[model samples]
Target chain A: MRALLVVGGHELRSRLRDGTAPLIALVAPIMLATLFGLALGGDDDPPLKATIGVVDLDGGEFPASVQREALNTDELKGVLTFRQYPDEAAARGAVDGGEAGAALVFPAGFSEGVGAGRGGQVSVMESPESPLAGVVARSMVDRISALVEARTLAVRASLEAGVPADRVQVFVEENGAAGPALSLVGDPVAGGRVDLAVHYGAGMAVMFAFFVVGTTARSLLTERQNGTLDRMRAAPVPLWTALVGKSAVGFGLALVSMCATWLSSVLIFGASWGDPLGVFPLLLAHVFAATAIVMLVASRAKTDAQADGYTLGVAFVFAFLGGSIVPVYNLPEWLRGVSLITPNGWVSAGLSELAGTGAGPSAVLGPIAVVTGIGVVAGALALLGFRKGRFA
Target chain B: MTPALVCEGLVKRYGDKTVVDRVGFHIDEGEAYGLLGPNGAGKTTTISMLVGLLRPDEGSVRVGGIDVDEDPVAAKRLIGYVPQEIALYPELTARENLRYFGRLYGLPRRELTSRIGEVLDLVGLAGRGDDKVDTYSGGMKRRTNIAVALLHRPRLLILDEPTVGVDPQSRVAILDRVEALVGDGMSLLYTSHYMEEVERVCTRVGIIDRGRVVADGTKRELVAELGGTDRVELTLDGDVTAAADKLRVVEGVSEAVVTGSSSIRLLVAGGRHLLPALLAAVGDAGAVTGVEVVEPDLEAAFLHLTGSTLRD
Candidate 1:
């Protein structure tokens, strides 16, 4: 343990002393988080900025009423601004020229036909190039069409039956009773701040853990090249003990870096981690797994350059597949399934669930088991890759 | 006295090339042994195999009575090594580096602290241990590297080109320190391509070429076995083909090799007897501007045994 600490201290000091390590490891992650967080938005998501224009060609008896109803709908109040143009050509031109992203056209007799128990087309025009705008335009049109029909139908039905406006309002209110309840797990954490912190903390730790492995592997290569391996071999310490000492240094350094990052997150950034007991097992499992992967990579690479490239490629791929950048929930189902096979994904998922909710600690168990299993498998491969009595 | 290190039939091969082929020797306690070789001669490879960094294809190594392959940890504990290249962490202070290497060998804290001071003084870097290694000169860095290796006070010390790139003064200082250590009874295996360095400091020398031991013994013994031949080169102002023929007939002269120009070199048993006759012969043909009689040394012995120039 003392030897391990000694090596760990050296590794830590080296990392702090290197200007590049701190920049990439700490500064980059924090900057990325802040930039991405702001870009995604704060609480109370406003409707995204999307340009929508309308060409109402319908000059009917109930046109004014239709316009008033369109203006009052939920979709139009804040989500969209409907601009009435003289013709579809002008609106289409505006959309095509990029002045607007989408255009809507209400055909002639559209409101009148709806009043007479008929329907008319509310054409949603979009530049196929802007697929997102097309989607937005279609959604807005659907809302407007529903609102116009509901108002027209209610007015026609009441006038034919000679019902007064006040009575009709009372009847509609009475019938619009309870709706279907939304189906989901349970109440989420009131604020997103805790979830965000745990997600980034676990992810950043996993990412930098790979760097620790890469750096240690490079140092091993350097030792071998410099003939120190042979020197050490002539010493009293066994080869296996030296290897253990080296690997333990990497493990301890990575652990300290992760712990410091965690502390910083909790104190400075207001990050709340999961249960301490739960976190340790999870982090321990991942650390070994990451170390094992690094060792295996180092063994395969004949040069420092090859090791560096391989570590980077594997680390990033695993981090991505593991859902470090985006939540597994937001990822495509196929990708989420892929993430389960990687230790990083399991760690992120396990940590987020454990730290985010007081009651959902059980949600972490599956990921924990998977991560530990990966560690075992990777550790076996790493040990196998390490040739015995070969350092000198 | 027991040998500080011994290896019998030590062999190591990489792929199709036998890098260190069936090489074996021993360094008695308190002896400074030098392994001299050219590039690709497996000097470094042999040292690495002995130190337990590489597994040999065949044979065994014993350092201070410990079997390296059978029990590497025990074997390693009894040895200290300094590599050809600088391997200390530049960002760390010399003291920190010494402490690190000491702790790596699992030295006790108090012992390590004291030994750090002693080794620093031994390498002549006593008060400069607090400075970062990068801040030190090349010679200073080399000294610290040696200090790191000496932290454990191993019975056998191995240095691979410890003075490869340092200034002449630094090289002398290093040689002096190495001699002092050997005098104090530590066995050493020093490898270098510098013939004079091996000739000056090594009690016994092994000349390795093409991954095999070509020659081994004391300097005078090997030189004697290779035969007492001196090289006498004579530079004349004009063509000396006729003069070379006349010098080759001298009693002590074995053969005379004439250059394409007005110079000739004679391989003779003793230059003291052959020099006057050879110089008179060169003077007979043309004006003799330069005459030199060089005795047998490691370089001459190397050329005779390997049939190639040592510099080549």
Candidate 2:
């Protein structure tokens, strides 16, 4: 145990003493996070806003309740900003010219059809790129449909009792506005500010943590090529101990780096990482898994140069596939399934769950188990190969 | 008495090339043995195999009577190896490097500290021990490297090209320190391509070429076997081959060869004594311009046996 500590201390001091090593390991990740945060605006949740143009070409007046019900609706009031469009061409032009995100068109026969007890449908045009445009277009169509359906139902009731359709429609339109008020249920994901910055920060942490493994593996190769490893073997200590000592140091540094990333997210970007106790241990476990992977790679490399090339190629590929560089949901199902094999994917998934709503202890258990297991297996493989001839 | 290090018929192959052929040698306790060879002559390979860094294809290595193959840890405990390259971490201080290597040798904390200090003093770097190894001169780094090997105070020390690229002053200091260690009853197996260094510091020298020992003995004995004397050469304008044949009939000349188109070289018991007859021989054949007598040293003996210059 003491020997391991001494060896680890030496490794740590060596890393800290080097100028570029610490800068890349510690400072680079944080800087990247801040840059991405300012650019993307926090999390994946977007706050959408749009200006919608409305055109009513109907000449005949509709029932007072129809207009009052349409204007006083709760669903459309908070979601969209309405502007009156004088004609269909004008509304369409407004949508195309970027003056409005979407256009609502009520045809000339819309009021007459509702007044005669026959309901009509409205058409909404929207831009392809705007989330707000989609939302506004759908809401306007649904609200107009609901208003027409109520008048139709009232006329049908009167006709069943042998009353005239015109008289029934006229009578129902007057009372339509008196129907029960529209109310929406409470929002489940409300007040959870969707900041793109948090996602960027989490992604950066996982990528950098994996990078540390690659860097350490390269260092291991260097030690071997330079004869330091052989000199160490000449000592009385078992070679396995030396290998384990190096992996432990790598694990510790990775864990610290992970913590610094999370802290920066909190202190600089205003990210609320939920509970600290849960995240810290999970991060440490994930770091252990990363360390094992590093050892496995370092053991296979015959020289420092080989290790550098192989580690960089492998680490970045795994990182990108696992959603460190891109989100998993945006990828195809097959690609998402492929990410399951990667520890970094599991780590990012685990971090998102910890900070996401509806997360529990079970959410973190899978990543912890996967990463820890990989670490154990990788550590053993490295140790075994190390004893054979890798270090020699 | 058991030898400190012994290898019987050691064979190592890298791919199709046999690097260390069935070579057998031993260094008795407290004896200084040198493995002499030119570049790429497999001297490093032999030392690596003995140090347990490379396993021999077919050989047994016993360090302090412990088989390296069967019990490497036990054998390694008795062996300290300083490789051709300086292995200490450059960013670490000299003292830190020593302490790290000491811990690797499983020295107890108390013993590790004391031994680190002792070895530092022994290598003549006690005052600069606290300075980073990278800041030290090439010689200081070499001294620190040797100190690493000495920390465990093992029974056998194997050094491979220890002073290959160092300055002359550092080379001399390193040789002096190595001599001092061997005199204090430590067995040493030193490998170098420098023939003079072998002649100066080694008690016994083994000349290895093409993965095999071509000759092995004390300097004087090997020189004597190759004929103990100087060589005289005469450059003549005419009939050099017939002049070479006539020189062989001389009383003191042991061997004669037409080394060049116009030159005849003769190995004689006494070059000065044979010079008169060689000049007379050149006169009997043709006009002679230059007649020179040079002493035969290890360099000459190596050239005679290998049919190649020592530098090449």
Candidate 3:
């Protein structure tokens, strides 16, 4: 244990003295997180407003009411804006010419058909080039259609019950301006907001945590090349002790980097990580896995350049597949499953759960277990390689 | 007394090639044993096995009477190794490197602190211990390297070409420090291809060639094994043929030959004792302007054993 501590301490001190380690560990993660956060729209920044082109060809109250709801509704205030076109051709032109992301056109007699309790037809024209705004416009149109159908049902029920049609209309009008009769409430999953800063903060942190692999492998190869390994072998310390010591240094650096990124995100960007108890253990497991991976790479490489190349290649592949570069939730279901096979995937899931739902230890336990398993397996392989003199 | 280090039938092979053949040697207590060989003579390989860095395919190494393979940690505690390369963290201060190694050897913090100071002073880097090793000169780095090994105060110090790239002044300083350690009764196994350095620092020498020890003994013993002969050269201003014939009849002269029509070379069993008579004969036959007597050294012994110069 003493030998391990001594060797680990020395390795940490040496790396700390090196300028490149800190640059990769701290600076790069912070920069990437900030860049991604800004690109995704920061919490304090105004949300992007997408323009929806509207063409109410119905020339009636219902179609005009839909347009009015999209234009003057408080919920869609900053989320959407409207450009009224005189005709379907003009609306389609606006969408195709990039004047708006999407265009909503109501066919003639659409409002009369809906008022007579028959289904109305409306066309939503969307540009493939600007999908986000078009998707938002389509959702708004769906809500309006649902409201019109509900009003038709209400009128039909009142007429069947022998209530006066004028009295029913008055009742409908009183509540129609009050918004949707039925509302769906979305509960916070784990009592936390799904902040972009938090998602990107964890992502960039995990991505840069793998950068520690480069530093770790390079240091190992350098020690071998410089004959320090031979020197250490001649010392009283066992080979396993030295290996553990070196691995501990890498693990410690990655852990500190990840924690710093989390803290900085919270302090600098107002990002919340949700529950320290869960986050700390998850970070530990992630760093351990990272360190083991580095050891495995270093053990197989005979030179510094070889180690660097191997580490770089592995880090990039893991980063990409594990959703460090891209969110796994954004990937296809099968791809997300493949991502779960990587340590980074587990880390991403764990961090996302913690940040999104204020998930406690129980929520992150499975991922932590898998990450720790990876560490143990990779560490065993690395030690085997070391004993075989592959590292030398 | 038991030897400080022992290796029996040490054989190390890499696939089909044997890097260190059944080579064996021992360094007794208080003796500085030199392992002399040309480059690629397996000197480093042999020392590596002795220090437990490399395991021999078939052999046994004991340090302070403890088996190195069976109990490497204990064996390593008794040995201080200074590699041919400067095995140090250049970014770390000298004191930091020393303390690190000291702790690796399981030295207590208090003792390690004192030992660091002692080693720094011993290596003449006491005042510059705080400087980063990268900023140090080659000599200083070498000294720090040695200092790290000395931190544990092991029973034996294995220095593998410690002065390979050092300047002459630093070499002298290193040699002086090594001599002092030996004087203080610290056993040493100094490996070098430089014959002069081995002769100057080692009490006994082993000449290795092609992974085998060709000769091993005291410097005098090894030299005496080569028929105890010495060579004398006379640079004459006049005819050297006469000097050659006259020198051939000297009491101790074994063979005399003339070369280049200006000098005569003589081989004698005791060239120093017969130098005066040989000189007189040369002067009588020809005007002897210059005379040089070559005594048998480690180089000559190495040449006699391996049929090649140590440098080659």
Candidate 4:
């Protein structure tokens, strides 16, 4: 154990003095996260307001009411601004010219159809350039149409039941201004909000964690080539102790890089990592797994160039599969399934759950267990490689 | 007293080929034993097994009476290995590297510090201990490598070509330092292809070739085993064959041969003692123009045993 500490401390101190490894492990990840966060608009800045054109051709109380409600709805107030157009041609022109994201046109006699217990018709025009705004505008038009349909059903039911006309008119007038007939309540999505900034932050951290693999493998190969490893073996220290010490250096650097990225995401970008207790263990397990993988590569590699190529290839493949460069949610289902097979995938999934949904410690247990298991298996393989004299 | 290191019938093989076959030797306390071999002569391989870095296929290595294969950690504790390559971390200071290896040997902090200072001074790098190893000259790096091995003060110091690339002056310094250590009662198992180095430092020599020790003994013993004869070349102005015949009858001359029309070579038991009679014999045959005597050394001994030069 003392041998392990001494060797490990020496390895770490040497790396720290070298400076290149730490720069890649820490600064590179943070830089990637910042770039991705900026691109994704994951910060707390307000969203852009979309301009929507309203064309009321019905010249009736119902059309005017629909327009007023769509424009004045609390949910759409800051998000969607409206412009009243004189005609369909004007509204459509505004949408086509990109002056408005979308246009809503109420056809002539649309209010009369509802008054007579018949369905009303409305047309929505949206530009392809502003898809988000167009979708929002269409949903608002749908809500107004739903209200019209509900009123028509109520009026038809009253007449069929032989209610007095005067009472029916009073009912229509009273209910028309109330609200939409079907009020939709939202439930949380299984994975929660896919915060782009946090996703990229965690992804970049995990991806760059693998970058240390190349350095770790190169260092191992160099020590072997330079005869330092042989010298160490000749010392009183056990071979396993030296191996453990070298692995600890990689693991320690990875752990620090991962934690620093997480903390920076939280402090700088306002990213919530949910439960610290849950996230910390997963990070440790991830570092362990990453370190084991690198050690295994180093043990098997014949030269520094071979180690570099192998490690970089593995890191990239794992990063891509694990959705580090792109969100797994955005990937195909089959691709996402493939991601789950990698430790990076498990780590990303665990971090996403913790950061996105405020998941508890229990939520990350399975991933942590799997990652730790990988570390154990890979570490064993690495030791076996060492025993086989592959590193020699 | 127990020998500092003993390897009995050490054998190592890779795949179907044998790299080291039944090579065995021992280093006694205060003895500087030189393992002289040409390149690819299994010197490093044998050393590796002895130092617990490699397991012998058919032998046992005991360092300070501890079996290396059975308890390598204990055996290793008794051995300080200086590998051919510079093993110290290039980015770390010489002092830091020594301190690190010292700690690995389980030395106390104060003791390790003092030992580092002592080794630095011993290697003549006391003032430059704080400089990073990479910044040092090649000779300095080599000294630091040796210093690291001495940090634990092991019973046996195994040096594998410790002066391979060093300048002549640095080589002399290293040899001087190694000799001083031996004088201080430290055992050494030194391997080198340089015959002069072996002759100057080693009390006992083992010449290995093709995974086997072809010759092993003290320098004088090995030389005597090779008939203990020195060569004398006498350049004459006339009748070389007649001069050779006269030299053959000299008191200490082992054999005499005529090589050219004007030169006669004599194999003498002792050239310096036999030279006067050899001169008279040469004068009896012809007028002597020049005389040259070659003494029997490790190089000649090695060539005699292996039928090859040490450099080859």
Candidate 5:
């Protein structure tokens, strides 16, 4: 144990002093996340945000309800910034003048007509310049229409079930003032909008982490080429102690890289990876998988140069296929299935899940098992390679 | 007395090929032994097995009476190994590298601190011990590696071609430092293809070839295996063939051949002394302009035994 610590401490200090390790491990991933984040969105806000105009003239409970829910919803804060107009003409003017991406106007008698089980009048004004915002507003209006119809049907059913007409009207006016369809309308993800940036931060992190922590394993071949490995082997300590010492450095650097990237994403780009308890297991598992894979790849190389080539090749291929540089969903359907085989894919999937709504510790249970399994299998294969006489 | 290191019938084989076959040697305490061989002659493999870096297919190695297989850590404690290349970490300073290895060697903390300084001074790198190894010259790197090997003060110092890629000045310094260590009662097992280095530093030399030790003895003893024959060359002004025929009849001349139009070569006993008599015999055939006689050395013995040069 003393020998292992001594060697590990030395390896850590040496790799830190080398300059490239720290740069690749700590800085590269954060920089990639920032650049990709900026390209996706104009800033750290959602990738697609636009201003929408709302004009209400209905003087009824249903139109008031739709106006309140659509204008000030926090879940849609990233995708929709709401503005108010005095009239439908003014709302059209805002859309035509490009002051707003889209607009909504509620006709008078909208609530009474709908409460009588008759249809209400509503209109969506859209602009060619901001089609996404227009689609988002239209989708919210459709959900509101559905909510009013469902409430009208319930009121009629209540009357038929012998509830007094006066009481039914009070119930309809009170509960119907605030619609429950806002969650589906406010959240772009639940409305079929994909946010690839959620995965980009941790995705780039794990990919670059492979290169950073992998160098320590590749140093085994470098040491062998330069004869330092033989010197250690000829010493009075167990040779495997040297390997353990190097691995401890890899694992430590990987941990630091992961935390720094996660923190950078949160602090810089406003990314929220939900519940630390849910994400911690995936972080540790990803680190182990990265280290074990590099060690296994390096052990199969005949020389240090060969080890470097193999490490880089594997890092890049996994990055592309696993949605680090490009989203896995952007690939062909068949390729998305292939992504399931990569460690980065599993890590990004877990991070994306945690970044979404209502995520708990159970969000990453599957990813944790898969990533940890990869580490165990790869670590065993590396040990077998060492046993086959690549120890020095 | 117990030798510092001993091994017999050491063999190492890869799948279908034996790289070292039944190679055996011993180095006594305070004595210097050289294992001389060309490249791929099994010296490194044999040394690896002896140092516990490799396991022998069919032999046992004991260092200071401790079997290496049974207790490798104990056996390795008695060996300071200097491989052919400088093995110190380039990113680390000389003192840092030494301290790391010294700690692994199980030296006490305070003792390791002091020993690192001593070894650096011994290798003449004390002034630059705090600089990163990559910033130093190649020779300085080699010296620092030597310092690392000597830090633990092992019973046997095994150096495998310590001067192969060294500058001329550092090569001389390394050889001098090694000789000084041996003079201070250190047992040494040095491997190299350089004949002069072995002839100068080692009392006994083992010549290995094609995975076998063809001969092992003192330099003179190996040279005497040639049966005291010497090579003689004579330069004649005229009639080289006739001169060769006349010299062939001389009392000590074993054989003579006309090598050139004006030169005749001879194999003879006591070549240095037989020069004058050969000149008298060649006098009738031609006027001898120059004469040369060659004596026996390790190179000649190697050529005689293995039929290949040291550089081969």
Candidate 6:
């Protein structure tokens, strides 16, 4: 253990002095964060604000419940502002006049058809001026619609179980007037509205961290070529000591890259990374997974050039496909699922889920577990590769 | 005293190719032992096994009475190794490299601090130890490489072809430092293809050929086994091949072969006494232009044992 730490500290100092690592690991991500953040309305820009038109021809408890429960949640505090229109034509007029990005209109028989478990429909009007506002409105409406549909199915099941129709009606009225059965405050419209600067900042940190680890992992081949590795192996320490020590430096660089980007984003861009308690595990897990992946890449590579090429290749692939090059919310829905397969994807996703002031603490738990799994499996394979490789 | 290093049959193989065959030797405390061999003769492979950098497939090595396989850390603690290539980190200063390696061998921080200066001074690199290794000359880099190895003050120092590509002056300085180490009671295992270096620095030498130690003994003992024969080189003005044929039939000449365009080399029991017969036997072949008889040395012993010169 002493030897491991000594070797680790030595490698850290040596690489830090080289200056390339500090540039790639420490500075590059901050620059990316600033560039991407400024592109997406920097900290000094006005907070995202859009008005959403709402029309209630049904004038019933269900549409009122959705407006009060989902559309007005604190999660959309700075992004969405709701307006009540007297009817569908008024809402459409407001949307066409650019008073609202989009409007949701509930038909007169909508609640009656929903209670009857029959045909029901709602119409939406969107203006071309604010597509993102339309998206936020659609997401919130879709969530509320799904919640109502589930509740309607439960009513149908109870009615089939020989419950009275009047009692089911009473249940719906009481619950609809009360708090939402599924709260929208946790993940609602603003799920995608996570401060873009913070989201892209986290992604940049994640993507560039691979470069830091690449140098450390590629050192195995470099040292082997230059004969330094053989000299270390010639010492009294175990062969694994060299690998562990170098990897410890890699792990430190990963952590430092993340924290530096996070702190710099906060200080420079005024972006809050949600709660640190929620943020830390994702940082550790994502960094661990990134290190493991680069180690595996380096171990399989036969030469230093091959290792370098593969490291850059993997970094870019993860960055672009995992939503680092573009914000996760901007990626296609299918690509979002694909993004979770990458270490960068999980980090971007989890960090974005916990972005902003009201972020739920538990939002990062899922990504943490998944990224940690990635670390474990990749870490195991990397160990096998190192053992099988010429790391001796 | 138990030998400072002992190996009965250290073997290392890669698939069907055995790099280091059942090689065996022992070095007593403070004795400088040289393993002499040409390139690809398994000197580095053998040294790797001895230093615990490589695992022997079918044999064992004990350093300072500790079995390397059983207690590698302890066995390695007694050994310092210098590779043919300069192995110090290029971006690190010589002192930094020494300090790191010293810490690796478990030297305490205070001891390692002072010991780094001492080792640098010992290698004649004291004032320039602060410079990064990449900024140094080839010879300085080689010196720093040796300095890192000596930081821990191991009981045995194993250097594998240390002076292969160094300048003449630096080679002399390195040899001087190594000779001083030996004089200070440090056990040493030096491997090189240069027979003269082995003869000058080592008390005993092992001649290895094709992964096998053909002979190991003191210089005088190895040459004495040659039966006091002298090596004679005769430059003639006639056909060298004809001259070699004539010299082969001489009574005292054991072997005669054409060495160059007009020169014949002969291994003779008493070269000087047989000189007249050799010249007379060369009557029609050529008049002897220059005749030289040399006393036997490590080169002759190597040629005798391996049937090839060290240059081969």
Q: Per-residue lDDT tens digits of candidate 3, residues B1-312?
A: 989988889999999999898998899999999998888999988998888878789989999999999998889989989999999988779998887778788888998888899999999999999998999999999899899888888889999999988888999999999999999999999988677788899999888899999888999999888686886667888767777778878788766656466866666787788778877877666778887878876665675577555554
Q: Interface RMSD values for the candidates, listed in order?
A: 2.7, 1.7, 1.3, 1.3, 1.1, 1.1
- Candidate 2 docking: what grade? acceptable
Model 6, C-alpha of B22: deviation from truth (Å): 2.1
Superior candidate under lDDT, 1 versus 4: 4
What are the runs in model 6 whose C-alpha is more than 4 Å off?
A: A42-191, A218-220, A302-305, A332-334, A356-359, A389-392, B90-93, B127-135, B220-296, B304-309
Segments in model 2 whose C-alpha atoms lie over 4 Å from true places = A19-22, A38-195, A267-282, A296-315, A331-338, A369-389, B109-114, B220-310
Give model 4's docking category. medium
lDDT of 1 by residue, B203-262 (tens): 898888888898889998878864769877778877677877787787877656665487
Report the C-alpha displacement of residue B124, candidate 2, in angstroms: 3.2
The list of candidate 1 runs beyond 4 A from truth reads A19-31, A38-202, A218-235, A240-243, A256-280, A301-307, A328-337, A348-363, A384-392, B232-291
DockQ pick, better of 2 and 3 = 3
DockQ of all candidate complexes: 0.36, 0.42, 0.52, 0.52, 0.55, 0.58
**TM-score per candidate, in order?**
0.70, 0.72, 0.72, 0.73, 0.73, 0.76
Tens digits of per-residue lDDT for model 5, B1-312: 789999989999998999999998889999999999989999999998889998999989999889999999999999999888888888778888898888888899999998888888898998999999999988898888888889899999999888887788998898999999999999999987788899889999898998888899989899898777676768879888788778888987766766577877676778888777888898778898888877877766776677555676
lDDT of 1 by residue, A281-318 (tens): 77777878888888778777777688788889888999
Report the lDDT tens digits of candidate 6 across residue range B1-312: 978999988778888998788999999999999998877888888888788777788788999999999999889989999999999888788988888888888989999999998999999999999998999988899899899889889899999888878898999999999999999999999988777788889999998888988898899999998887888889989888877887788898877767678877778888789888888999999988999999987777776777665655
Candidates sorted by TM-score, descending order?
6, 5, 4, 3, 2, 1
- Over the stretch A5-121, how does candidate 3's per-residue lDDT look in tens digits? 888877777777777668888888888787877777366432235678888778877766665655565444565677889998898898888888788888888766665446576
C-alpha RMSD by candidate, in order: 8.9, 8.3, 9.4, 9.8, 9.1, 6.9
lDDT of 5 at A13: 76
Q: Considering DockQ, which of the candidate structures 3 and 5 is the better prediction for this target?
A: 5
DockQ, cand. 1: 0.36
Off by over 4 Å in 5: A41-197, A387-389, B131-139, B167-169, B231-292
Lowest lDDT 10-mer window, candidate 3 chain B? B303-312
For each candidate, the alpha-carbon lDDT, in order, equals 0.72, 0.74, 0.79, 0.80, 0.80, 0.82
Which docking class does model 1 fall in?
acceptable
Ranking by lDDT: 6, 5, 4, 3, 2, 1
Indicate which candidate wins on DockQ: 6
